[model samples]
Structures are given as C-alpha cells and as structure tokens.
Target: MPDGGPVIVGISRSTEKIREIVRKVADVDLNVLISGESGVGKELVARSLHYFSSRKKRPFIKVNCAALPGELIETELFGYEKGAFTGADKQKMGKFEAAADGSIFLDEIGEIPMSMQAKLLQVLQDQKFPRIGGHKEIDARARVIAATNRNLEAEILSGNFREDLYFRINTISIVVPPLRERPEDVEPLVYYFLDRLSKEHRLPKPDISPRLMKLLKGYHWPGNVRELENYLKRLLVLGESKELEAELEAAGDGWNSETDTASSQEAVIEEAAKEVLPNKNSREKQFPSLKEVRDKAVYRVERALIKQVLEETNWNRREAAKILKISYRALLYKLKDMNLTPH
Candidate 1:
C-alpha cells in the first residue's frame, strides 16, 4: 500500500524524490539511515516511515544517543539480566526489546561509542542481540531507523566510528533537506508556529505584517525548522517588535547577538575572537594532516567561544550581532549556518 500520510508542507522534485523513496521503503525491514544537518526534521521523516509501514500500530521508541552516558548506552538499548551492573537490581528490557514488534528510532546515532557500534552492527545483520549480562540471545525483530547529523563516513575515516556499522545502518539512506533548501515551506511554518505558539503562550495571535514575512524568507535558516519554531514561540511571549526584527537578522545568516543599544560591541568581539582562536599551545602547535580534524578542532574553539560570549551577553542576540560587526539579522544567519546555539 502507498503512504497515506499528509503531504509534507512543501512540494518540489527534491521532496517528491524523498516521498518516492519512502513509498518504496515503507514495507521493507531494512535498517535505514536518516541523514541531515541539525534541526532539519529527520525525526519527522522517521515517524512518517513508521506510520506508513506495516507496523504502524506498534511502538515507536526513540533513543537519543547523545542524551545518555557512553558507558550505559549498550545496556539501555540491549537490556541486561538482574544484577547486570551497579544499578541493575532487577532484569531490564532495553529499548530494542521494548519495541520488539514495532519500530525503534535512534536519534543522533553517530554519537554512539565505537565499541558499541559493533554490537549494533551484529543486531542489524543477524536480527538478534544478547542481554548485557544474560546467557541467551533474544529475538531482536524490531525495525531500526537511525538518524544522525554528523557525517559518519568522516567519522569512519577518523577511526572514531566503525565502517562495518556504517554500512549496516546505512543500508537505506534518506537525506532531509535543510530549511534554506525549501523556502516554499517557510510561510506555512510561520503560520503554523505562530498560531500554536500563541495558544501555548496564552497570547493573542500575532499579525505578521507582509513586510516581516519578506524579511524572513530573505534570510537563510541555519538552525533549520527548530530555530524558526523557537523564535516564533518567543515572539508570542515577549510580543516585542525587536524579536521579530532580530529573527529577520537571524534569517540573513548573520551571528549578531546584540538586543539593545546598551550592548557592547567591542567587548563581545574581543571575547568571541579569543574563544574561537584559543591559544591551544599559547605558542605554536603542529596541526593535523586531516582536514576533518582541523575543521573539527576549529569548530571546537568556535563553539566554545560562541557559547561563552552568548552567556556573558545574556543572549541579547541583537547586541551580540552588533559586537560581531554584522547586522543583527546577519548574526542570526551565521549562528544557524554554523549549526550553533546563539548567545
């Protein structure tokens, strides 16, 4: 049977191609890898797959790999016998077992440790996984849909991820388009969030002047849908015109954090610069040969600096934007572009 789900908000060859693939894959028990940058709604695609699949009525369990400690993820997923470890006073059913006849969604799958990747691989290949401290292999028949924002191929190359596990989970891959790639969806999303946020905040629905709509579409959404949704929710609460203006600047792909006249541009910039280009050596340090390593390291310093500056400025995005010497709108764009949280 074809997917009877609602048509996704926007329509285009790209989105249609995705729909086409889902229609084909919905009935199969393949291990699917849903890939995209942060906030691109990979989880939406996963839910759609489960709803349209043969097991629609079964459980849809979500496991956020990044939300747990690396030491405990395996037991969390594969279960353990009574007394498996320090806290295992009783036998436990892990995520895989809990969703036995349904589907399991593993979000941020790339965050799984290298050692555990092999266990996941065995489960995918053989349809079986043993309890952490138990003797017998249990029937692990649930369909697996895993999502990740990181490039696992890069992780594999860096030896931080397993190649075999990548091949296993990536048996079928679906890449969700970023918000910037689908401008047609913006208006609908704004309307959707505005109304819902208004209701949630117990406020009157906002009248987004046509001018504001234009400004929003003109900006690039680096944080994807989540950023847009969050911004609109804040608007319903604050009801400040500046929130709308700040969102416009954010859409412009800038990293401005200044929210008022009192914001100190010089102070924000000096702190931001130091945070991003930290004196790792306080002298000279030999750089790595791999571009990914270098990029990851640069991103490391950049993220740390951004986080610190945002904290110091109390998340006054407009002022932070001014400090960065970019339009407040531009700063919003860059923060999203960097897939980073703003200060």
Candidate 2:
C-alpha cells in the first residue's frame, strides 16, 4: 500500500507477515510454492513473482497440472519429440522448455499423479529431462513456481506426493489467506471490480451502496478474491446503466414477487430489503426494462453475484447469503432457481 510496491489486502499480523514474505519471494528467482484455497488467486501471486523477478522480460508459462491427464503430465511438463506418441505428429516443447530462462507456474501441483512426481522431482533436481521417446536431453533452465490448495504434508504422509519433489519445489512457501479472514478487503475489492468493469466496458463508474458495504463487511468469503471479482463483474453489468435507485427497486420487486404469498415471508424480505437496499422510488422505471426482462436480468445478476461471492468466500453459503442480504436458505433457492454454478 506504499511506494508503488503492491496492494496487500488483509488485517491479521499473519497476513501482513505473509505479504512481506511474498514480496521478498517475488524479488528472487528461488523456487516458490503458493498455497491457497481454489479461488484465492494463487496464479495472481505467481504472476506477481514473475513480474517482480529479473526474468520479467522472458516467458512466464502457467501449466495446470491438475487439469492435465496423468498419462500426458510428463510430456506436458518435459516436452515431447516428434512422433513420440500417436498424437505427437510434431515436436512440441514442454512448459519448462518454453519457459527457458523464465518462470513456469505448475498450478494445482497437488493433483499430479504419484507416478509423475519422480519425473517432476528429477527436473527440479537435475534441471533437465528427455523429451518423450527421445534420446537427446532437454535442459530446464526455467525457474519453478508451484501452487496447490491441498495439504502437501498430508499428501506426503499418505505417499501421494513425493517427499523429494515436495522439498525441491517448495524452497519458499507463501500461503494466501482466504477472503473470510480479510473482511477489510471486501469493500475495496468490490470497488476495484466496479472500477475495472467500468473501464473495460467503457461504461460510467458503478457504485456499491453503503448498505451493501455494511452487508458485505459482515459476511464471510469462502472463495476469496476471485469470487469477489466475479460478483463485481455481474454487478457492473447489472447496474452499468441503471441508477442506484433502479437496483433497489429491482431488489424490492424481486423480494416482493418471491414472497408475496406468505405474509410472514413478505415481512422478512421487506425488512431485509429495506435494511440492505438504499431507499428509492420503486415506481420509477430506471432500469429501462419491464417486469419480465428486468426480473430475468436480476436473476442473472443475482446468480452471478452470489456464485462469485460464494467462490470468493470459499463456498460458505451462510457468508454468501449475508452479503446478498438474504437468508442462507434463500440463497440456495435463488441459486437453484437461476441454475447457477455451484462453485
């Protein structure tokens, strides 16, 4: 937050210490292991490291070890010679080769199969590996950065992750705390996304109401920064052209239509809506869409916002519901109603 270094989000002493560690790690070429939850933006840390390192001008390759098939993990990491396999019609450089004199971020490293761990270990140990079905050796001059959400120590104990590989790639470890632990960041992150979306879409600046901020501050974020970004994206899209007055009206109508049948439900929704939404004229057609399209748009916006917040908050339904100013059960219903992605 000073001297144009980087934006460090979070309040705890541990987070501050971790931020310092990350900044120091980013300044070197040493092996870095970024550990965090799925949506905590480990890749962001990896990118930051590459940018901060001397190798910033060189390649910065990111490989999703978790998504790669176990059969091809070796080839993907170490490259393949021409005709090495049925699909190896041409010579293909592995991530390490592509990242020569650069950085390679092996994401979701914990999901790498045990069979391939030794080969990975060898590359880290020897800085070289033979392309698949080739006799000639390929040097791996790239710096290694690995990320994972899993507990590698537990995996090593379980014989799933190689101890040597673990020790090799984790020369420096940086744990990114989840968003729930950094409530202070929620407000700024929401504003950041709002700004980003505004510029990206060439729309006017968007806003998150004070009531919404209060609601956001009280909620737990299981998914972390990634989730928060997604919600802001949806909010920007939903409110880009609509006045602040419009969103409140829409939320009000949404609350009314969903709960009009039961008097008790109406009271609950009304109370929460009033508490969370800014006071505005409900009679105005500020969003420029009628009942049907507006309702659908709200559903889309709500689903996107809720799912992103959940992802940012680490899928904690309770926390997500609180941010949305709804009950946990109501959030579930909305998610189901919108056919939203679970994670």
Clashes of each: 31, 9
Please provide, for model 1 over 1-343, each residue's C-alpha lDDT reduced to its tens digit, 9 standing for 90 to 100: 2255544555656677888888899889998999998998788788888888988889989999999877689988998999878888999999999998899999999999877888788888888878988989888888999999999989988998998888888999999888877887788888877766776678998778777787777666779888888877777777758667865766464433332312454455555555545467667765445765567656665555555566778888887766667788876776887776641
Instruction: Assess each prediction's global lDDT (C-alpha) against the native.
Output: 0.79, 0.75
TM-score of 2: 0.66
How would you encode candidate 2's per-residue C-alpha lDDT over 1-343 as one tens digit per residue?
1234345555566566766776687767689898988787688778778777788789999999878889788888878889988988999888889999999999999999988887788778887888888988888889889999999999999988889888898899888877766777677667766766788788876666677676556544456687667756766667643454354455544544444446554454455444444347677534433665555555555555666678878888888888879998888887777777653
> TM-score for all predictions?
0.69, 0.66
Best-matching candidate per lDDT:
1
Clashing pairs in 2: 221-313, 222-313, 222-314, 223-311, 223-312, 223-313, 223-314, 224-312, 227-312
Q: Give the clash count for model 1.
A: 31
Off by over 4 Å in 2: 1-15, 240-343
Candidate 1: misplaced stretches above 4 Å?
A: 1-7, 198-203, 240-243, 250-343
